[model samples]
Target: MRRMRVAAAMSVAALALAGCGSSTESTPGAGGASSSAKALKIGMAYDVGGRGDQSFNDAAAAGLDKAKKDLGVETKEATAVNGEPESAREERLQQLIDAGYKDVVAVGFAYAPSVKKVAAANPDAKISLIDSTDATGPNIVNLTFAEQQGSFLVGAAAALKSKTANIGFIGGVNTDLIKKFEAGYTAGAKAVKPAIKIQVKYLTQPPDFSGFGDPAKGKTAAEGMYQQGADVIYAAAGGSGGGLFTAATAAKKMAIGVDSDQALTAPPAARPYVITSMLKKVDVATFDFIKSLTEGKFVAGTKIYDLKANGVGYSTTGGQMDDIKAKLDAYKQQIIDGKIVVPAKP
Candidate 1:
């Protein structure tokens, strides 16, 4: 899906958006959840690794935490197990629904199928499916981010900071979802300096979500790139991203992190090497979705959160990225003005 373009650092005037790529109205969905359901009981189901993945799942957790503090909404959370049956997803969702939750969120691309099935079965429950821009369910509103847009910014940052003019990109699973990350990173780096070398690898192929959780494999993949003269590595490998940080520090190089600001969330030993992070703003989207429901304006459709909406951005913690801010801003403005359109595929 296409998104409305905006300056990467521009402030979003309104947090609640209705349509895809643009913010307007989150209208009450027709067939899914009962928007009028009493007492907001929200639940969120995380992808594998649950709370401590320190990447995607942690970002979503931030949203849930904010909802609890600001909205004072009662909430429940669950995580997936790798070897479980396909029915496992539906069962987790059903358990929450049975436990009196009227609103639930499924985090990750893998949840698209189960969210579709479960949301259809529970027509009166509001469901928010994160990561699938094209996800559609009877009572679900898809909360997706323009990851490519964010990836581009960090890619440019890597180019600016690289001493060897060589960087690497590591993805958890090789899919259209992660491809967006690779595509944007490559495009952004090239835009800054042609002939820059990018080493790309995925932890695993499709049907293997193990990529997101395997730090050992991640370390091996990133270390390979580091040995090849890559000075910076941008990793969108969820928990596996930790290995990228480790390798970067050991090699005396820089690293970029995904989802949350790894410069802050990463372990102290790995923090120094995290030059910056691509922030997905998942927490903002999640809280906004719940806000829509509570406000009686919940809309069910594919909503794309992108640079324009501040849905995707880069972290500036520890002043490590301070030097390259000007260059990053210029490229960001170019993308916003449509002078440069980051590709969704590589």
Candidate 2:
């Protein structure tokens, strides 16, 4: 299993290099924009928690920061406010556009409509909308991730470590996007133990994305799962993931984090409970998108970050997952080898 994993991981690395080889030859920015601009001006419109959420938003911020450092790019940032009307989203994105930001990246799927509208209004602007699969426009680049592929790895790890043969999943919001996490996790857990008990819960539903930020609600939901016999839980709830970490610590259980490496970023008290994180490689996507734009290789279509491309994987930090690396790697190889097709829906 370990050998299979190493070989599979190597394949992804090689493919990643080949995959990015021609990104420079992609379609020019809208209006056949030139890369001779005075400076690389980039803009970021973050989700509710913005850069400090220690989850999804933070991952995006990492990429933007890398761009600023490596490319010496000038940047503008916009924050999301809960329950705000769609007009507010449009205004936030438009503010950056009007501010002369040549490349603007919207950080969440909720910005789909606004991105579509804004990108259309500014046909010459370079727009990258994350987590969006559709929304056609001249310069609109949809950035999506193979979240299910990564989620399955973490689920298998949880199953391997669970003496109770029970695990849990907590999603921030009930949407097609979050469902993908649940589906992949359940499949992976079952694959490992065949009869592993999986508990699932959602923090909130659409039109109410507050679940991503409500740590209290997250703690309560995770506590319920833990009480019901789940020894480990996977959290895909953005900032709310912090609450799951807290619950894991208090219950003396384990929690799998998402997006960034939570073992390094979670609060000191909760960090110990974080066995591993499903790395979504948002920073890579963000930096690559900006890099493409600056180099005039900006493509105006969907770019998928999937396991085969090393865009998603499970973190092996802190050595907590070392004991099960072979098992986890086997599953990873299977997914990359097309032996396992992780579902994007529940």
Candidate 3:
């Protein structure tokens, strides 16, 4: 089973790379806009995992690719040093602005202060920060996702798929944002099976902020949960989730992934174990915002994309998920039809 899982993981990785390569080279922005016609220069800064973790960074890159192809925009990207200071992030943003990239998209909450400050300094530049709420300046747009709604669906799935009724949640940080995921997940699991057991763990407490990149901690947390008799686990720990997946695979248990389609992100041994993922449409949001810039319809201030807007939901593909797909679809439609209200905060 382990060897088969490894083979499957390798296949998924190859497919993902192929998908990325093909999509990235096609037209460069939305609608195949002419790059020669006053090319719009854009830059993006990634969060902890950088580009290849196959999660948030990759989703943002997908948006940039769409912008490049459809809108004919020139783009560049910068990586954050893992476990580094926020000052380094700020310096990179400044460098991008200084290099004449007028429109910038910073990919994580860690970039909030830097994005706000940089946007304030360069009034002419348009900046959008995803997964963060600190961009309140005139030139910056804050993009926040309704991750709770999607997490609710995945949580429900975890409850349904669990043979042991005991589940676990591992988070990157213990912030209100990450708590939103935990709260929704807990609520969703309870909604499905009121007696379900959930063991919650956080990779970091207050002030550390290393939770997102700490896979070692995530692995330890997952192993602890497994020892505690959790048969299914849900990870909202960014790069840390990779460790959780590894633990699940090793324990021969199941796990639920987050952010992007984690069924594709995790190693093969964890793929079949990953029943489904909370699909937060970061790529779509990024692409749409950049398209708005091209069409002169760029809206400033905070833009919230929730389940109702198709900006977030649960994944249905990647094998062994067909049985739960119908239920997920029904729940999704109910949410859209105003029959269900998924909470945004814990």
Candidate 4:
């Protein structure tokens, strides 16, 4: 499954290089639940931690919320459980589609196979997949992000704000996708301070995805890094990031967030330690997917959201990044202008 994800990303890169990163097509009479005569009904399948992770899944939920209010769409949502089998994911999606939900959004790469299988079985269903390009079909739309680019910015922020010049990264899972986060973070930090000391840890390996949802493991990993003289940490560990934030607060250190503006979404007690966040813009992709269906312009292909497309970005909600925003923005523009290339792997 993990290898498939990497290959899928490489395929997406090829598409981008070929000038086919994204394109709209009229799925004539293939609207499924997107009928123009009735309210659009959307079914959202979220990764672990659902709406309150204050990270990835929450970003998806925010899109759903906006669609509800702005588009007046009817919607239903479901979440995956830690360590569940792929069959479970398939069944969850099958249930949503069987219940007359013609438009379904699966919110993580773990659902790639399930989305492919379910969509193939249900020809009338319109499926939007977040975070992976492994699945493709007439009805399936893959929404992927340049997480490395955003992580690079926050990684630069960590290096710039680190008083000890020693920072850390905690990944929820040891996979190619999360490695992109590590790669960009490492490259960005080194770009700023060549001799900086950096520590890295992964909470779990594949088939044991609890790493993405386990706060206790995140806290333990972060505590160890902080004790080893790292003054700032960046967490790409979904719900586990909450634990990292807690650990940062206790250590009187700083931490970076991923997928959302966690300085504004993290638990109140841990907010102060969040210097900045890597914005993945899942909400924007989610809304755009639904909106396109409404406009009869549902695009059926891989869409890569990168620094150039404003799909990924950095957030400075708490003014902690005020001091160095200029430098970070400069780096961001360099990446956009192709003057600096952020690596997708470390």
Q: For model 1, state the Cα shift of residue 111 in Å.
A: 1.8
Error of 2 at 310 (Å): 1.1
Best by TM-score: 2
**Candidate 4: clashing pairs of residues:** none
For each candidate, how many residue pairs have backbone atoms clashing (under 3 Å)? 2, 0, 13, 0
Q: lDDT value for candidate 4?
A: 0.90
Summarize candidate 2's per-residue lDDT along 1-346 as a digit string, tens digits.
9999999999999999888876755644444434456778898999788988888888999999999888878788989887788999999989898888857999998899999888888888889999996676879888899999999889888898899998999999998888888888988888888988999999998778889888898999999999999999998998888889889999999999999898998888877789999999989999999999879998888889999889999998789999999888888888999999999887
- Alpha-carbon TM-score of each model against the true structure: 0.86, 0.87, 0.83, 0.86
- Give one digit per residue, the lDDT tens place, for model 3 in 34-85: 4475798888888867787677788899889988888788877888887678
Q: Give me the overall lDDT of model 3.
A: 0.85
Off by over 4 Å in 3: 1-37, 82-88
- The best candidate in terms of lDDT: 4
2 against 4, candidate with superior TM-score: 2
Tell me which of candidates 1 and 3 scores higher on TM-score: 1
lDDT of 1 by residue, 209-298 (tens): 889888888899999999999999999988889888888778878899898888887879888889899989988999999889879899
Given candidate 1, what's the lDDT at residue 215? 83
Local distance difference test, per candidate?
0.85, 0.89, 0.85, 0.90
In angstroms, give how far residue 56 of model 4 lies from its true place: 1.6
